[model samples]
Target: MFMVYVSETQPLVDFLRSIKNGSTVLMASYDEPATKLSEEARNLIAEMGSTYVKSLGFRDNWVFVGAKALPVKLCLFQHIKNNDKTNVYENWPEIIDMDGCIPKHME
Candidate 1:
């Protein structure tokens, strides 16, 4: 699986366009405030023929379109609102490998 940090739609669209037919994409993001992705991101993802996962309430741990075992060509994207302190996903060791103040949800 590939990992791509999605802060905008261009990169996402570029990656999607590069994918082969019948291939799968697995995406992950930290719904941070800085992420400026528009609704077109979702629309393009769907248009590119990739599945979208609805993984809410899991904080930093989520899958794209709720797909299992995301394909090898999958990508993970994220945008942090506050880059100075710590990312919301930073506390989740299993997801993000960063040493910083752990969020309460992780504790």
Candidate 2:
């Protein structure tokens, strides 16, 4: 299991690319995840089974759990919109929590 707080796109993309197949990855956003996010990074995350990555916006709260090189059914994620009406704080969405068991990788 790996936990990450996405702040920079390059490091995140490199990290995502380096993980072995069947490795579990968990990611969340801090202040502003998309400010410096790149298309490659978004595509990478989307390929990891994130349905919301392409639409992720500034200050949106996001959390994702996925298994590298695994099927999409092995992924779980959620995001909270940071728009004016949905934000809990100025320019930020409300915090979110997620919990589940990921199937262990078997050789």
Which candidate number would show the highest TM-score if scored against the true structure?
2
- As a whole number from 0 to 100, the lDDT of residue 61 in candidate 2 is 88
The TM-score, computed over Cα atoms with residue i paired to residue i, of candidate 2 is 0.82
lDDT of 1 by residue, 1-107 (tens): 22234344566556666766544444555543113444555555645333432222223444342122333333333322333245443543234432333112110
- Whole-model lDDT for model 2 versus the true structure? 0.76
| Candidate 2 lDDT score at position 4 | 32
- Tens digits of per-residue lDDT for model 2 on 37-72? 788988887777788888877788899987677754
Off by over 4 Å in 1: 1-7, 31-35, 47-61, 65-107
Candidate 1 backbone collisions, by pair: 1-72, 52-65, 53-64, 53-65, 53-66
Candidate that scores best on lDDT: 2
**Candidate 2 error regions (>4 Å):** 1-8
Worst 10 residues of 2 by lDDT: 1-10
